[model samples]
Target: MAGFDDITKKAQSFLQDGKVQDALKSEKAEDVSDKVFDGVADAVKKVTGGKYDDKIDKARDEADKRIGNE
Candidate 1:
């Protein structure tokens, strides 16, 4: 789970980008966020050989919810 934390932290940092925040408030917020999160998770999957794919995806999904709620 340590790997999960590490990746999620990185993902969170990515989420902090101004572009991401802007994207979250766009007309297509859900679609944009989903694409971005899926892209990030896909990259993590490749880098970690899918070992942490589940964790990455789970974190991305939860983050998506938070973004949507906000």
Candidate 2:
């Protein structure tokens, strides 16, 4: 039976072929940058007491580009 390894391999293959990226570029997924990354960056900043806000925002912008939202 298929298991976690099979799922992981399939997911990796999909990412390698840019399928996941294309999917993320869809209109439904377009707001993922603000909806997801903003919360992530906020949490990181809170954890670090806001010391890394600038760096976190920069990294978040880079990640947003990867997700096709930038």
Candidate 3:
């Protein structure tokens, strides 16, 4: 479906964004905790009415992992 394809493209783009990855590797990012990311993801999921909860969770996990403090 067109919607699914668009979602896939966005997901891939996020995953491939070196700038975001690099930013997440910064010292400030490293000081952030998984709990904070999880809280933010939860807030985002709620704001989106759970429509993009899966994607939000995946992105949060990826970002948290990039910080390398989790």
Q: Residues 31-61, candidate 3, lDDT per residue (tens digit)?
A: 6656688889989998999999889988987
- List lDDT for all candidates, in order: 0.82, 0.81, 0.81
What's the TM-score of every candidate structure? 0.57, 0.71, 0.51
In terms of lDDT, the poorest run of 10 residues in model 1 is: 61-70
Candidate 3: what lDDT? 0.81
Question: Native-vs-model 1 lDDT?
Answer: 0.82
How would you encode candidate 2's per-residue C-alpha lDDT over 1-70 as one tens digit per residue?
Answer: 5798899999888887766777777766768666798899999999999898999999988887766445
Model 2, total clashes: 0
How many collisions per candidate?
0, 0, 0
- Give the local distance difference test score of model 2: 0.81
Candidate 1 at residue 24, lDDT? 71
What candidate 1 gets wrong by more than 4 Å, as runs, is 1-27
Candidate 3: Cα lDDT at 70 = 47
Q: Higher-TM-score candidate among 1 and 3?
A: 1
> Which candidate has the highest lDDT of all?
1
Against the correct fold, how does model 2 do in TM-score? 0.71
Tens digit per residue, CA lDDT, model 1, 1-70: 9999999999999999999877776668877777888898898899999898779988998888866433
- Residue 63 deviation, candidate 3, in Å? 0.3
